[model samples]
Target chain A: MIPGYITTNAPALLIAVPLLGAFLSPLIGKISRDARALWVLAVMTLTALIGYFVAFLVYTEGTLLYVFGATNATLAVPPDSGGIPIRIIFTLDAMSALMVTIAVTVGFAVILYSLTSDARRSGLEAYYTIFLLMIGAILGMVSTGDLFNFFVFLEISSLASAGLVAYKVEKGRAVEAGLKYLLVSTIGGIFFLFAIGILYGQYNALNMAMLADMIQWTPLDKLALVLVVAALAAKCGAVPMHFWTPDAYSMAPSAVTAMLVVASQASLYGLFRICFTLYGITLNYVTIGWVIIILGILSMIIGVTMAIPQKDIKRLMAYHAVSQTGYMLLGVGVGLAVLGDQALLNSYGMTAMEGGIFHIFNHAMYKGLLFLTAGAIIYQVGTSDLNRMGGLGHRMKWTMIFFIIGALAIAGIPPFNGFASKFLIYESVFAFSPLLSIIAMVVSILTLASFVKVFHSVFMGPPLPGNEQVREAPRTMLIGMTILAAIVIISGIFPEFFVQNLITPAAHALTDQAGYISAVLGGA
Target chain B: MRMSKIVRFGADVLFGAIVIFGLYVIMHGHLTPGGGFQGGAVVATGAALVIVAYSYEEVIGMIKKTILMAQESAGLVMFAGVALIAIGLGTTFFFNFLANSGSLFGMTVPFGPNPGELNTGGVLPLMNIAVGIEVWGGLAIVILYMLSGIGKTKEA
Candidate 1:
């Protein structure tokens, strides 16, 4: 039972440590204000350690699986399968393990940063409780193998994130936004549930691997596939289903807002898993790609256009979130459209997909950094309105520096993480389709323009009405932003390293539907 | 905080029925049309029923912000808990571990031929129940907060 020493089984401690910490947070919070936050940080630190170790195990030892109930008897077929039957399965390939590492790292940073921000002293113990739950749910979502189990985790992540948005009950707008997010997110969750139901009904199994074996090109299967993709799109804030993003981000506490940004990115990973694995990618997945492409293009145009007029900084970032999603999806969509056609998929489409997936991690780093920086500014200046913020660079030098790097990274400037991913998408798209490449280029340039405006208005101009006495953010916030800023820079410089290791595995995971399905349920 | 005993009794019965039905739905998810989320929505009806029958202030005071928040968060964590076990076991995300026919409390039960059968799947029932609690508690808290927030707001 010494699982850590066993190459085939990862230590369950990675998830246990954080979850157990979450359960004890309330009780510990009563003892000291910082106790719960520090406990969470410690838990995530442990989670990251375990995640990194597990990832190292998977990388060195190959794919590792642990059946829930420890069955001594093996299944009829499929080597490395369950022993005693009726056990929850945990399978870690490189991709899932990597994501766990990223999520845990970012989560730790966020919790640490919040400890020093006004979020700590805000008498929002319940808020931290939900925050920890969210981190745990995301960890669960990324790491689990059961499809039904995945849906449940999705709901947990969604609810906790929405709760974070409404943490400030005094802001009636936040409450309203939470409600809207709930309604839409609930619908998404329901659709996901329905898709699970459909898969179970037709396949007579909820195991992803077993279900994939049972899948055939039937109308019912197509419908289930559509429902799953649609539901995921809503969660990812794809266009038409993306109405909730701006309000939810604008209304929540800044710490919560930063967390939600990362949470949403994590959900996109789910979308990729469901679409590619649950429904075999070889079958008409390309059609869905067209749909996603259309949505992505629409979001890019509309999100930037909308951002041009925003007065509030968070709201603008909110629109940009949508626009950025478009950029990510552009590569994904292109890869999907060409998946069935080997010629198109080979040269650049694969690279494009890698670009999109790479951008997911890069976006998480830069966007989370930017949002935290925004939170820092709001912490000091007490406003997220761009028109109201001026000369903040002089008052909050570290915060401003972090914000500049984040803005540069987000705007796809050279020598930044954003540019690295955007370049992949750009070059790959040009090789595949000039028109799509043109659109992507336009989006990139506009992104730069938008952040420039943010810089000029928020950081460059004369000190605004109330910023005369605005002080710098606390050291904890600086640490979080600094960590992300360094990551962004490293990713930018080591694009090849990231693509070869992290992005390629993620892209391959998304593309290798058979591998994903077989790994989860067993070989068909 | 005072209300007629009859009114209070009626609300209690209604809530009791809804709670029971929601639990049944959640537990029977593997075998039936209803699952955790649907059952959770049904449970929230009990909260709504209580809100409608009682004074808003009383209902709000009884539930309390911290408790509601805790319930919502706990439910979320519970759902994640099942997945955490799977992660620890080195299975794929959300892999069901406890899905089998085993003797529990000296009762021998048969899980049907398919893994999809009720009581056959591993951890699904538990996950479903966790989701049920989350959906029930989360929706209720969200709605209550919204209603009270809106009720007190003045038009600009």
Candidate 2:
């Protein structure tokens, strides 16, 4: 294990470093603009390194616990407590580590992409400050074991991200979208807090492991479960609750939009944490699983159908985000439905979970690249409206290629990461119910068709007369897109390796509640 | 936008008292119910009182934006630095290494409903001050920015 000098404090460092960067960003900005950008980059890179290091340690050494204000990890036990952890606990298992990995990677990519992308905006210092704050809060949200702490981080991220989403001061539309996003997330956060209160009122514990062990599945707990799931699902953009996704995604700066994509995944992480680890087998799996599966199908069908007619490039891509999230919902929902049924689970449930988890990684990479490409086009052409763009591909060849790769991968084409994960979902979900797989396949085709329409409208045809001299994106932006594209390609071609090393372990850790609970409370 | 001279004078007089009360609340945070966030809000109310009485230009002069920004960053850096101290001391991050060590902000005391000693909160008091400073700066700056934004719109 890599539990060396600094590794033991990796959990806290992962959040602390970025938080330091957040305030330091504006300070450094006051001195010099370039210095502030470098500061943000340095901060994100440092936190990403710490994040991956923590993930590595957790992966290798089993779960690593870091308790705040405690002398050591084992000192988390309260003196007169009923085996409940009173201190703030950050429990990093493979699942949380996976989420931390995504947040760090996406955050790093967003920082690099926006280095030059947001040069035109005023208040760059404040922009970087909120961006870093959101990053730190995201890392906090994914890794913390305390429910109320999750709510706190959730609020911080919502505020920070809504601020970023409203970065374009001139674009009144962006601000409007930001306000709506904020209002919706505030309600969701309050609902989530109420759920936490219900749990706390019942068991007098905020720790997930403690609640998992002390659960008497009363009616109030069920109500709490509904509120938590509904709130988190809305936050993550599951179908029927995803109106904010299109508004927020389309209006945000491309860089912030990319990060927002990953942010939703954090909400997904929270949802999965509640479903699998918190409730585990104590909840009614069949009913809840069916509920999730239905939501997944709705998201897949409606998201792609909505994307087909979109003239706005970012809005189109935003709908695609909804569709991609559906695959994950389907994959994980299948796994949830079969919980405690050993024969069915052993046959295909695990693969479904791996597929869902793997898609989180793959979707982040491809969708980020896609958004950056969309941003690049908008940067050069001065609009995100697809009707207003054409033949910039000749000038921006690299961007075109990157966009094509992103489009194809998102369409679930072979030799790309998306195909590998979606294929796994299709192959395994068939075992549970072939109808669901058929619908998924049809949705994949519709997704491909939707992207083709976008590609034709935005990148193909003769150059528009006004944009005769349109140029490729800046060097840093291209480099950022290339980094994500390379990840998409590598994970696509060698997905088995990722599955074996990261996804399978994460899936196992997520499903195995006994191990997760035991990791926190010495065999419970 | 300055209020009448009487109101302005009253605001000026009340600001000092409000700030002093806020400081007391922050200093006794570990012993009392009101901590960093609450005390910072109380302090920010004083800033708001001044902002309400003075014109935008005069308010800018009275509460310099750059200084408030600096104070905010300083508070955050200090808060983070205190936590980072645990990392350097060969303990986990946020570990209360100073507690019960009989050092600065580290005096041990018996747990009870009795009045607690000022020096007995370990790093908690330091954290309170840091957060208090941050919240004060943050809230004042927020009001200033909002008013300035409104000012711009009216002129436009």
Candidate 3:
């Protein structure tokens, strides 16, 4: 049996260890670079372990509620407090556990890749420090059961990631990209705060569970809901609010770009959590669901079409990130559309949600792998422009292989994780509306076309001038890519296994609003 | 460019006073309105005054960037460490294990209104101090770095 202390405190430890490690990284760097690298590795490894352990416990035992600063970890509401949980609580249901798992896994891989890829860069200590802090913030954002706490983590992550985006200050335009990201994020954050104030004025509660129990879909609630959905959609790079996605993703160091994908997904998680759990069936589900679906369609069409004409390799991939986010929104939005109808929901809505959530994992792994490969190319070629690159397939064998795997997975080719999720989404969404499925398929085809162009441009022809001597990526970078590659293949081949274990539980946890409320408030 | 002698003298005189006031705010945070962030910003404003009074080279000598960076990191470490100590003591993370324990900063206050006690509020005071030190260092270093960047721009 797991130690009681560990099982009890795993949620807090999952966030705290990385936060402590971030502050301690700079100090250790004062000792030696190698020491600092090893320190970061140990911290990330421990965080990943705790993350997976909490996920395991949540999957097996059920939703876990950890109340901070309480007499006991499980004491969400004091006996005399009249059913109100005043303290900050972490609600680690299967949905939160899945998000945590993705953040830590990508975090570990990114840090490992950065160890060798960024060894020669200046300001190594600060880079790793901000990296760890971002990881902790993402974990905190997904797990916290308090709206105010979620905002706090959101701001922390925004600041940390903005700093990392500008880490390559000498690289012209990076600082510009970082500034744009910060400005956009700050605006979104203000909107979120405004909505929180509106909700607090109405409900006088910050705990999500309490607020959900009390929400009555008043005018103020409707106003708050609009503000929240807009803010979260902007944060997650949805259409018309995704202006910063290409700039930020293209300019940040590759490892940071990879983790940014997960960061945005955390915002997506917030959007879903609010819609499904906090509001649930109290509001107009069909209207809100249709709104999300329209956003998804816009993102898919615009993201892929824009991606086709991009000359910069990373920028191309970044647009694809926007496109892939649509698939997830499409899948889950379909689920939300039918949420009020139990019979329809039982037939296809759950499958759509499972597909959406599963796609989050698949997208993180494959997209992360793709970004790492692009970084490797930039490392050797010193440019991310497709027009200036060619014929690296012979020299960088492993990077080429990883790129192909990521490319195929993202394009939804069979036997890849992306295909499994997309297939589920297609079949389920088609049942909802045949037109939506067709739009989604067209987007996937465009995604494939763009990647094919990238593959041909970067690795197909004879070696371009001054690139003949380019060698394979370093051992650590290759190993990092290898880890994600292996996951993509395994999950693709065994989609049923992962969907049954991870995605279905997450879908249930998200849909079961009463269960979530009762878990924290103590009774039905 | 350096400021006038009168401005420099005024800054020098007010620096110590500003820092002490900030410390007072930080120390009495649990009982008062101002806490670590506010107090630390107050202290940092004093440092900014010093920076404005002198030139970049002179300010660099007065406040070393490395030391300030270390100070910021140390403060955050301490804050997290104090919270983690609760878990070590068999309570949840951030639990006020010292409150009402009759130890340091552990005196129990009466329920009704009375004169506020300095030796109460358990770990809050400690956290305030930690955050105070951090904000002081963090804000000061940001100003220092900005100045350094300006110096570089001028050279170029």
Candidate 4:
């Protein structure tokens, strides 16, 4: 049974609030622009509060399973159906709860940033509507217990985010890039649905727990697995499949680009969920793990090298986002590779998983901050091209500081959040293969090199002749960046605590498949 | 892009008939194959017929953007609000509190197929109507926005 508090339905309310907000946004916009903005902020903040409350409950009370449309609300298990849950259920485990926290935080910050940025122009109604819908879709994608439900949410998010990416219609290229993003994401969504259909056809179950129990790991199952991995990999921008990342990220408004990073993370989270939980020990772990690792290395090397030559600031960050996603894949890939040995899994593999999971939160913060700062520059200078940027350190001191923190944090420098997670990854991965650790280190140095170039090119030069009137970004944008920058700083200072409190529980939730299965089935 | 007067007159008659049929499909969804989405598509078809019969300028004059948006939003709010009512009733979200409760949309049915009561399926009918309105307004809005886009391109 759920807890006896208002927080009992927080998980459902978390999704409901944003969804209702999205529908109401245009209506409220008709009343007054300021009312519409306040309404959006209020809705987002409410969702965030509910998100944190549910996450805290999950942390303290173990996993929570919520079944929709049940005759008996507390009963997830139907009596006569032999321990099968019939209706739609939302499972709030530690892993999903953590992701929910990241999504809500980033979304709220982005909305705040958008209030004062270039996104505040006309058409604010459609902008906020799609914006909230995109956030709700991400929440749905990360939190749903049904596989088909995840696919549905994934499609919604991809479409909504693509629409948001094209919000800047004044720029012809934004529309073009949005079409490409939409094309690739739609194709990936189709393949993902096909994979879900295969699994459903075989097992006759849409619920993840029931499917996990019924799966036979047959050839068809392996085909389904490959399709899932490929689809999610493409959506999340993994190496060979990552061509759309730069185009979409660079073309979208900066606030939108920040949220897009989190959207891609939701896809990566789906990939991990499918690999570790759905298919778990049923398939060949070694080969699949190698597939992820090779992709990680390629993303790391290719992404960083590609970023170094970029003239556009947002495009550079987009490539680096791909590179940073590599760290997560490599860290978790090492965990997957060593899952065959139980003793190895308990010791090194679990640590590797924690490192990867830790990086998920850290990257969302610093990378989001980086994108927001890029947006701030664009807001001030009317461009994101690095060649045309200079001397913002004088007028926009706060933005400069924030950008430096973001750059330093992402480059894995000491006493930053990136260094802490990358440290865990390097230390744990070395035992699996020293060469992997070495490659990760080289990627880190290259990351530093690229960011230093950005710092010099964007903020360290003399003010250009045409840019004398450039001012600091609006107070709201600075406030938005400050949220992420503060998170990056605090998490960096207390990595051990965050790891113990947040990352460990999430890692346990992922590796503990039997816990998930039993939690649902045992409820009967 | 207007059609001839006879074609426009025929479309005007067809629109009313199609909307009635769509509402029939939506209302009878509890006992039939076609449901809210299908019914909504039917209604949208009616809207498309209207748009096709008139010039883009004439169509813009006839269609109110705010009204369609309100319809869509109101439908969504009704849908979510129905689900939220369960939470207010100390049950789970979308628990169908009206089911077997003898309230609106509440009347228990016997097992197996029989002559269905209009109120037998509980919140399902409500959900169907809500989703039908949402889809109807959503599809119509998409067409209007697209036609407007075309108008802009033609001017440019």
Candidate 5:
């Protein structure tokens, strides 16, 4: 079949449209501040609506590919027949669609919240523009089928995020944190480039689907695999490479910081995409799983241990971000390990993988809510320092309540979203390794303890000297927190809905090599 | 002051050679060793050399700030445009339209999907060049911004 313009490639538009919109924004912003914000918001809202339509199209049409420019019609190819993908390839599958849904919905909520708060409103035009680009980039990263395209989108998101982190140049550590983040992300980018070069050299192909079929695990292939995994681990803030995360989170403007944390999550998605979709997990090396599990364990221990000593509320939460990532990776890693065992693979392994992916959505909600609440506190009391704050429950009742809800959810309390996923992980891990389960439980307990310190210092102690003037966060911030809080609870109550509709399909697609290859090459 | 001039002259020649070499590499990406990223970085070095050799204001004037910005945006647009066109061509996005194995300029230059004329393959080489331009322009802009900040401080 010759491709036509009306092909099912709607996913590519979700990215291209917003990218075009981003370039138009600063010019539009130059006209008037309000005009700029409105334009960006309009574009974002439109992009979100388009994203919804794409998701709908995916469900209705099944797998669809949007070729950016032009393509050859050949279904199956002789050797050296297909050329490099010169255009952007947005391939929409169950996994990509799910990620796009989360990104756009959360993005909409964040933009709406920004409108109500004056703190973020002053830098309004630049904020919305960058925010929109971030949304577009993440959506593109998830949907793109080409390997080089993935790296381009990665750089777009990564660099834009670095700029946002340093946006608050007046803040003492903001620029320093941004610089450190830049250095590490640059290194990560180089690792990705090296991997890409090796893979390209081996197969002479950059398309994920094609590469999946062509890739044979030669010594060079193994080297590329190691490099790619290491790079992604750094991006995911997996232990040891996670040093820059807390500082970057602590320094960026609250709204930006809240949005930027999702970068690491998307990068984790990148890792899963490459490992399962590109590498086909059945290959006999247990090293990948072992390495991932070790990193997960270290992240859990170190993240929680570091959190125990943090006096700054933001820094503590950042550490928790690292720790929580451990749970997510542990689930996925356990799933990988158990794949060779039949009963375990289906009942426990898939369960663990689903748990990890579900936790991605869960963390986005609870952790984002936590950061927004922290932003609210900082807005009111002008400090994220835990030791300096006291008795904030009296003044900022709603903020404290929301914070508690988020904290509880993150602590994996029953009846919250976190617990539902945590339970799956615990059951899976316990079946595999009881010792790992124990450590996971210990990390959860310590997470709760760390949040308790935040609660006691910020909301329990007597109001600090000269702190009486602090007031509740504005309605906008409240709305942001409320939306995330509601989702956290709703997801907790209705785990099956999310699992059935989103998590299961995505997990299946992640592990489905035949499905991916057939979609790209017409048939295996 | 004279030493600065000598350093500037050396930097200028080095940067020029790098820029030319980078383009040479990118143009032959499909057949040979070099590609967009390497070439683009070299192009960015040319911009950096200017900053070192002359006043920031003077360099900005020579390149034209708007032109630099336009270059960045245009590269992105071109890259996307190539991909979109590939879709229209009845295949996946970014499908290479002009990949062949051929020799050019006394050198055997591989060009398309099959070894043929320069235009035989799809649009890959074009995309590579576009990406090269974007990388060069974007990095230049960033470095210029940082350098401008330094320029401001020196005067103050």
Candidate 6:
């Protein structure tokens, strides 16, 4: 039997361990750099273990609720509180579990990659601290069932990521990009807070489940929804508000850019949680659904078209990040559009949602791998410009292989994870609307074309002057890329297994509003 | 870049008083309106006054950046450590284990309004102190670094 403490406290431990380790990083750095690196690794490993353990428990037992500051961890509503859950609660269902798994997995790989890749950098203590804090913030944002708590975590992530983005201060452009990111995110955060305030003023509750239980779809609530959707859409780099994304992603350290993909997905998760759980079918589902779908289409079309002409390789990948986010939005948006109709929801809406949720996982893995490969190229070749790179396939064989895997997976080729999710999306979404599906297919083609150009320019030609002596990426960086590469390949080949086991459950958790509400407020 | 001697003397005189008041606010955070963040900012304001009054060279001599960074880290570790201790006691994280247990900061009071007691909040006061220290260190270091950067720009 699992120890009772471990089983009961895994949710808290998952976030707290990284937070503690983050602060302790600088102190440990004082002792020795190697010691600090090992400490960070140990902390991330423990966090990942606890995260997977929690996911396992959530899958087997259904939604798990842990009430902070309570005598019993699972006691969400104390007898004295008169049927109200007053304490901050963590409500982990399959969806949250999935997001947590993605975060910890990517976080662990990024830190491992950074260990050797950034060994020579100065002020590494601060770098590792902010990275751990970002991980902890993402974990907290996904798991918490409190709106206020979610806001707190969102701000923490925004600030920590901004610091990471600005870490390369010697590069004036990096500082400028970080500033833009900071300004945009701060505005988004403030809008989110305003929405939270509106909801609190109406319902007098900060807990997500409680607010959902009491939500009345009043004008104030509608306003709150608008504010929330806009803020989170911006935060997640959807369409018109995606100006800061390319700059930030291109300028940040490669490992951070990879983790930033997961960070933005956390915001996307919050957007879904608010719409599905907070509003449910009470509000106007069709309109909101179409809004997200339109955003997705715009992102897909514009993000790729813009990416095709970029000379900087990382900037091009950053645009792809925006493009991939569109696929997820489209998938879930279709599900939302059909939320009110039971017949339609059961027939294709569920599949669309699964496709979208599965895409979140696949996109994180492949895109993370792609960014790390780009980082590897930069590490060996000393530049991110495609024009300045060539024939790296000879010297950097492992990196070339990793980059090819990422490129193939991202282009939706068969026997890769991206195709499986996109296939689900296309089949289901075509049943919903063929035009949207066609747009999506065209976007995929553009994506493939862009990556093909990038691959040829960066690796296929004769070695350019000053690039002939390029070498393979460091062992740890390759190890990091390999972890994600392995996942992309394995999940691609076994898509059905992951879809049936993890994605289906997570999709159900997203749409099953009554089950989510009852888990926290109705049950013990 | 030094201020007038009179201004420096006044800054020194007010620093201790400001810190003491800030500590008072942090200690009584659970019962009063002020809390760790506010109190810490107040203390940092005092540090900023001192930083402004002295030259960067003299300021570096008086207050080291490494020590401030350590202080900030220690404060956060302590805060997280206190929360984690609850897990060791076989309860969930952030559990108010000491509340009414007659341990450190463990005093129970009757509900519905009475004269406030500083010792009744269980771990909140300790959390307040931890945050106060952290904010004090964090805000002060930011000011110090900014000033140092300004100094470098001037020299260049």
Each candidate structure's TM-score, on Cα atoms with residue i matched to residue i, is 0.82, 0.97, 0.99, 0.97, 0.83, 0.98
Chain B TM-score of every predicted model:
0.77, 0.89, 0.92, 0.89, 0.77, 0.91
Q: What level of docking quality does candidate 1 show? A: incorrect
lDDT tens digits by residue: candidate 5, A11-54: 65687678777766755766786777677668778888878777
Model 5 deviation from the true structure expressed as Cα RMSD, one decimal place: 5.5
lDDT per residue (tens digit) for residues B62-132 in model 6: 98889889989999999999999998898889998888988888989668878897678888988999998
RMSD of each: 5.7, 1.9, 1.3, 2.0, 5.5, 1.4
5 against 6, candidate with superior TM-score? 6
- lDDT per residue (tens digit) for residues A300-407 in model 1: 888888887889999999888888888878888888878877788888889998888888888888888988998898888877778789998888889888888888
lDDT (Cα) of model 5: 0.79
Off by over 4 Å in 5: A1-7, A59-61, A71-88, A115-128, B1-144, B149-156
True contacts kept of each: 0.09, 0.67, 0.78, 0.71, 0.44, 0.91
Score chain A of each prediction against the true chain A by TM-score and list the results.
0.94, 0.98, 0.99, 0.98, 0.94, 0.99
Writing each residue's lDDT as its tens digit, candidate 6 over A364-447 gives 999999999999899888899999999888889998898888988888998999999999999999999999999999999999
| Ranked by DockQ, top first | 6, 3, 2, 4, 5, 1
Whole-model lDDT values for every prediction? 0.76, 0.89, 0.94, 0.88, 0.79, 0.93
The model with the greatest DockQ is 6
Error of 5 at B94 (Å): 7.1
Interface RMSD of each: 6.5, 1.4, 0.5, 1.7, 3.9, 0.6
Best by lDDT: 3
lDDT of 2 by residue, A1-524 (tens): 55565666788888889998898888888778888888889988999999889998888988878888676754566667667788889988899999898889888888898998998789887898899899899889989988999999999999998999888854498899999999989999999999999999989999888788788779999999999989988988999999999989999999999999988999999999989999999889988988989989999999989998888999999999998999999999999999989889999999999999999999999999999999989988898888889888788899999999999999999899999999999999999999999999999999998888888877789998898889888999998898899999999999989999999999998888988788778765
DockQ of predictions, in order shown = 0.14, 0.67, 0.87, 0.67, 0.29, 0.89
Worst 10 residues of 3 chain A by lDDT: A164-173
lDDT score of model 6?
Answer: 0.93
Per-prediction backbone clash count: 31, 0, 0, 0, 36, 0
Error of 3 at B121 (Å): 0.6
**Lowest-lDDT window of 10 residues in candidate 5 chain A?**
A69-78
